[model samples]
Target chain A: MKLELGKLTIRDIRFSEESKISEGILYVSKEDLRRVALTEEKIKSADFDIARPGESVRITPVKDVVEPRVKTEGPGGIFPGFIAGVDTVGSGKTLALKGMAVVTTGPIVNFQEGVIDMSGPGADYTPFSKLLNLCVICEPVDNCEKHQYESALRMAGLKIASFVAGLGKDIAPEETETFETPDLLTGMKAFPELPRVAYVQMLQSQGLLHDTYVYGVDAKKILPTVLYPTESMDGAILSGNCVSACDKNPTYIHENNPIVEDLFKQHGKTINFVAHVITNENVFLADKERSSNQTAKLCKMLGLDAVIISEEGFGNPDTDLIMNCKKIEAEGIKTVIVTDEYAGRDGKSQSLADADKAADALVTAGNANQLVRLPKLDKVIGTMDYISKIAGSSDKALQSDGSIEVEIQVITGATSEVGFHTLSAR
Target chain B: MKELTILTNNPSLKESLTQKYPYLRCGIEYRDVNFLKLLELVRDEVHKGARILTHPLDGSVKPMETPYKSILVEKSDPGLDLNSLDLIENAIMSCRKFHFDERELQPRVIKDFQIIDRTLMESAIDTSGLY
Candidate 1:
């Protein structure tokens, strides 16, 4: 897949107490740019046009810097994606995912709605969605009497469900897209016959994948199913107040993180470690600045990667947090995560950005379409559309003319108030 | 015909300076000489076209609140005796680049001293429970 990516320029600034005796100039560093300018090494070798006192000295246009170039446009269609329905306590994340399934299926899909009462954010739905196409309806599975799984199948209106006589024969086209209604058994108000559907009963562990069979009209097909721990399968989800509060102290980090030993387990995957700082209510308001400086200091003292700060601290464009880490990852530091700076509100934003920015930022940051915030449903649907379009195109998403192409769309939904949500591609 | 001169922080070192430079007369002008004042005298004498010789503890040399100062001689005349003048000049230059502040400039200077007490430092290590 051709990933449309933004052009990057790296400028390292070093300062003295008094004034800058030397300063580097800015220039395009992409390989394509190298075709026009002399080689960076050669240019730097030449007299750097002695910089006058305050003027920035142009070191040979930083050349041959590798930048992300989009190889192809995204696919067209729903793009076969998943949604993590993360919702806080009392929020309607499961209902929303179910609602979405109904809208896409084009029928009155009345499934037995499994309800669960919880006190914090819903379960992590991203992993579950990855494991199964079926939206895992989360509920306190032990207490709930009627198996929600069975009830969902019953709601699929068995009458509307088509049954094939032979196991291998092709089913009628009309029977493929059936919405199991609760009352209708054979025929629906609109369609003459019902489509094929199936009921499944299985106990699966969290994050584990289970195989399921659907007895549709055409043939039996097996698919993956995931077991989620909560009822609200999707929506905006975040760290609970308790976890957020506990993540601050340096002592807590040492106590929590296994450090070099545990790091091996996630050596290649991104792992963010949040360190909470204890502070009075008054200081919490301005804690963003204080915490960021502290994070930088701690990271430095440990002799950890300097790039770790990019994952741990707040920055402008909000997207820099992601793009910067992507740059680090590109350099062979396989995994990246913030080990500190998750204290203040902005820290929370940066923490979430660290997750989304890694992939989304590179592909979407430079797109001019970034400003338009679509309604919530529209955003999800639009992402499908954009992905489909890009995947279908032949022209490289990264243009030869040296211009960045982006399809940034702000997905506006009834619940933008839920704050930031973290999504990892891997 | 030496142009460089050195002033001693110690009155006794003045005799050593005269012997080292040979070209210029050494010793206090006996006008309220202190560390900084001696340095000012040497620099003034050097500017006045007299060759001079000095030691590391030249009275003319001033040390800040820092424990050690740059120990060197100021040449009032560059055209004096090259051999002996060069020896003193090289010695001062070597020490100039090496830092001799509160920190040790040489390992020998702190060989037996305890830079940090191992037991005390270890006690400060935090064993308290982390949040």
Candidate 2:
């Protein structure tokens, strides 16, 4: 299959009489975006706010962040299964809003909703800080179930992103990048001498607030499966979970996975970049065993010389990461695993809940336990009520000085597992 | 009854602990792991109340009859999923942050041994008082 990505560099976003893109500036209509978000009755009401670079703004209880993109020429549109039909996307032309993100925020479902500070020392760890964030804050109707409310909020982010991407539907892209993945035999034939590489991406599927969706189906219900590298960029997989703020793969990260982008850069040159495997991190032990066993089997069947395995969330998933690494390496396939650390506040505790000597080629995405003090911003998007009770915080987090002390994990996308950000420890 | 939970991530800490604190009775270890059992303890002397025991890993074990059955989860307030939520909580709980530039992870394990010493001393006092 083949996919061509047309990049529409979005330099700025503002409210306008009508929604459209001109000179790389996206003029979004509040009524239009809110209308799309409130389509789901689960969301009591929705509103739009903007946070830009260098702004003294903070968005809190952030549920998910999604990049706006649309398929200009394809069998399916962007976010194929959920936004559009299951038409098997990633085979045609697609347009993307390059620099802006649709960030969803609302009531804290669990203590896992993250914080995205637009500026300050706090912004250094979060990747979303650099993007022009169109913040959507939603409130659930009285007494909506936590998971139901989370589902509504998750879809709202995707819908708003889709709505904004529609503004540039007809605009010509400034640059286009094409990606193609032929059948196994054809790809091997083309790069027979290159090392065959594959990517094993784990999805957070512990259920409740920790979940991921593929083609609108809950990932926890699915077995390990293979995907085309382009499909994920086209929104084949999405973040539908409220996992701990730091390491969870938010929808924005999935839409523009750095490892996928990096692997493609090396695709035809040094490595074959043969396949992409999607696996789940279920809570049950049997599920972990089954998934890891099958993942190793897939690697062996593909004749992969090496593979990169990236995990989502942490703890239980660490076992999955190690199991996959050990099993795959035991099959004679070299493996590199990407993960984050929880080496305690003092950086003196063991980082992982599980570990093995087999995991030699490991990449740490900083210590989530590392602390950061975020200066109070001039304006806050979400409520401060959740600040103290949030996962990384105790009642003492919001201090008398109004400066909040928190771990980098409280900031959204701080220690991304896929090398998504520059924040890493020695 | 007072209880002591061993808090350590060292796998060898469990083995070394049995030899280090011979008087301390062993209890169930709770880890987030799916395994049924992690260690074994056979006792010739059963002491009543205020047990000092340790199960030094991440997961939580099932509740047992003894008061000291809580594993690393209950022993430490550092949070359950060490790599994600716990990392965030512990870092914030410290109030102040410090960087560790040392390449060695030896300090963390060494500190766990010290904890074992202090906890065992307290348990020894409690066990002897039962007379």
Index of the highest-TM-score prediction: 2
For candidate 1, please provide the TM-score of chain A on its own.
Answer: 0.20
Report fnat, model 2.
0.00
Assess each model's interface with DockQ, reporting 2 decimals per model: 0.01, 0.03
Which sections of candidate 2 miss by over 4 Å? B1-131
- Cα miss at A125, model 2 (Å)? 0.7
lDDT by residue (B1-131, candidate 1, tens digit) is: 43222233333333533453355332233333433454455445545544332222211011221122112233544444443343334323322322112322233212101111111111111111010
Q: Give lDDT tens digits, candidate 2, residues A1-426.
A: 899999999999999878988999999889998899989889988988999988999999888999999999978877866899988877899999988999999754435678988999988888899999999989988877667888899888889999999889999999999888888999989998999999999998765566688887778778899898998888999987776788888888998999998999999999999888999876544567788999999999999999999998766577778889999999999999999877767778667766678899988899887888899899999877677545465546777889999878788888899888868654
Q: List the residue pairs that clash in candidate 2.
A: A369-B87, B30-B59, B30-B60, B30-B61, B31-B59, B31-B60, B32-B59, B32-B60
**Tens digits of lDDT, candidate 2, B25-94:** 5332334321112221101011121221221221111111001221221222222332323322322222
Instruction: Compare the candidates by DockQ and give the number of the best one.
Output: 2
lDDT of model 1 at residue A410? 13
Per prediction, fnat is: 0.00, 0.00
Model 1 CA RMSD to the hidden true structure, in angstroms = 33.0
For candidate 1, the clash count comes to 56
Instruction: List chain B TM-scores, each candidate.
Output: 0.28, 0.29
* Span of 10 residues, lowest total lDDT, candidate 1 chain A: A98-107
